[model samples]
Target: MQVIDADTVARATPFERLVPALRELFASGAEVPPRQVLTLADPAGGAAVTSLVMSAWDPGRYYAVKVINIAPGNAERGLPGLHASVLLHDAITGVPLALMDGDAITTRRTAAASALAASWLAPADAREMLVVGAGRVAALLPAAYRAVRPIERVTVWARRPEAAEVLASRWRSDGFAVTVATDLANAARHALIVSCATLATAPVVRGAWLAPGSHLDLIGSFTPAMREADDACFRGASVWVDTEEALVKAGELLAPMASGAWRSADLRGTLAQLARGEVHGRSAADERTVFKSVGTALEDLAAAMLVQAAAG
Candidate 1:
């Protein structure tokens, strides 16, 4: 098997390439099985260990398996809280083809997916962007948003005000108008809002605070017990997801569904429908659009395919 490091993966897959690949993978007629998650908890540290396994097949073209480990406190030491690796194999022969850095693949594919969703769901004239959380994903949001919208102003909010300011400064140096917001409500008032934090139990942005013609992308909260958006958020907007199966299991849609404010049918459609033109997106200029992403195996498989091809 060819070993691929993070830098190699970054060089191999670009956001532009991954976005369309993901769009096509979802739009194409294919089958991807649900992911399996195994969890281990530490009562003393008040944390849990999670291992995720995802598999997908585009039938005769490719197949892949991504395994990820999640430990919440690893971020305290300046390391990513989540780590992952992916294995690509020949569909016909079952031979191991490539081993890739799953963390980089995950972030890139996720940002690309969010950007793709924004392209269809957000207004074409969108000019402002707000991102929650100052982690690696937060740093990538602006580039992803700019790919889809005409984002002129970028605002960032995190539990640590200093970290928010730091990220804002970095973005400013990169030639974008960036600011740090003390209140998440103030951040939510932007034209496009991206949530990338790892808070497990609290809602950061309130649905009432969202402006009309706004696009919200919730990329955190990968488990049923975690929620970034409140029930009212779902009630106030048209909800779209990467996949209905993944969303129903663990996504921003979970909490609202659990609270009785929303139902499974409330989901207007999936990214595949939107991309394939089967479903309408942002019917009106003033419509509130929310895209809830729980991440997907097909996205990883698609991205890994691109990376592997580029590596060769």
Candidate 2:
């Protein structure tokens, strides 16, 4: 197995390549099997284990699997909260083709997916962006926004004010106007709102703060217990998702469904439909839109394929 580090993966995978690859994978009718997640906790020992396995298949030849292990206590020691590995295999022969670091793959592919959704869902003239959460996704949102829209400024918000300020300071040095907002509502007032947090309860962004012509990307919630956007947010906007099945498992959507404000059938359409021209996206410049992503395995497969190609 060839060990690929985060820097090498970052250099090899660009949004230009990964987005188009994902579009092709969607166009070719690829399917990601249900992801498997396992969690273990021992209260007295203060140790927990969380593992995730995601896999997807292309038409005839290839399949990929990404396995991740996450433990929460590492952050106190200045280590990543999660560590992962990805494996690519030939479908017919079941031969392992490549092994790579999954942490970089996760961040890049996720940001690329959000960018792809924004490109198709947001108004063509979007310029300002608001990113919530100061972790990996917040750092990536600016780059992803620039790839899809002409982002002129970015505002960041996090639970820890210092973390948000630090992220804003770095972005300002990079030539973009960046600000750190103490309030989530203020941070979410921009043309685009991107949320990436792992908090298990309560909504970080309220629905009323979203302006017309805003595009909201809720990326943090994956399980049935976590949420970033409130039910009112869904009630006030048109919702689109990367896939229908994935959305069903997404906490951001499931919460609203339980409240009766949203129905499973209320989903506007899939990203595939928009990409294929089957559904109209952002019908008017002032329409409110939201894209809730649960993160798909197909995205990892698509991005991994691109990274391997670029490395060649």
Candidate 3:
């Protein structure tokens, strides 16, 4: 069996290509069961450690499982909070095919999924993008969105000013008109697409600040305690998700529903339905849309298939 790392994964499935592959994967669908999370109590009395197991399979091709570790306290040690490994096996015979870097595949596929949704929902005339949070996902999101839209400028916002500045600098060197944003409200209002990937428990992106015709892409906040947008984000906007089940996993949707601020019926549709044209997306050029995603194992499986095929 082959062991694949980040660089190899990159060569296998670039974002632009992965976006189309993700579209096909979501459109066709797969067996995406609920993820399993195992919690380990810290012996040192620190924060509990979390290990997530995500698995999915397409009947004839292959099945894959991802083991992801989340150690939040590691940020204090200047380490990544998320890391993972994934295994892909032949479905019919159960033969191991490859071991892949889960973090790398997860990050890229997450961005591609966002881009895939944006292709269907984002304004056709979108020219600017505001990416909240300067984490690993933030660095790659712009390019993915730009692939489908005409984004001319990119702005990055973070809790730490230096982090935003550093992220902006890296993108600017790549010939992108990148800027560090201090005023998130102003940045969000002017942009056609506002993509937020943050761990903030409280709302960082206000619904009132969003401009008309803008699409809000919520990528982070998977747990019930975490949320990135306020209640107003869904007040009247057409809300959508990667999957209907995502609402159960993402606090961004669950928190409001728990407080009676949102309703289950408010969700217009899932990406799959939209892709299949079973439900319409963005009826008007000036309408508001929101796409919320809590990571799914099927996306990882589809990504692995695309990457594995490319590698072969």
Reference-based TM-score of each model: 0.90, 0.91, 0.95
Q: Write one digit per residue (lDDT tens) for candidate 2, span 88-201.
A: 777788887778889899999888888888888877777778888888766887877677788888888788989888889889887789878877676676545454554546
Local distance difference test values of all predictions, in order? 0.81, 0.80, 0.88
User: Could you give candidate 1's per-residue lDDT for residues 209-262 as a string of tens digits?
Assistant: 888878888887766777787788878688888887756566467677777888
Compared with the true structure, model 3 gives a TM-score of 0.95
Q: Please identify model 2 stretches exceeding 4 Å from their true place.
A: 39-48, 72-79, 190-200
TM-score, cand. 2? 0.91
Give the per-residue lDDT digits (tens) of candidate 3, residues 255-285.
Answer: 7787777788878888889878898888898
Clash count for candidate 1 is 0
Estimate candidate 3's alpha-carbon lDDT, on a 0 to 1 scale: 0.88
Give the candidate number with the greatest lDDT: 3
Best by TM-score: 3
lDDT (C-alpha) at residue 55 in model 1: 88
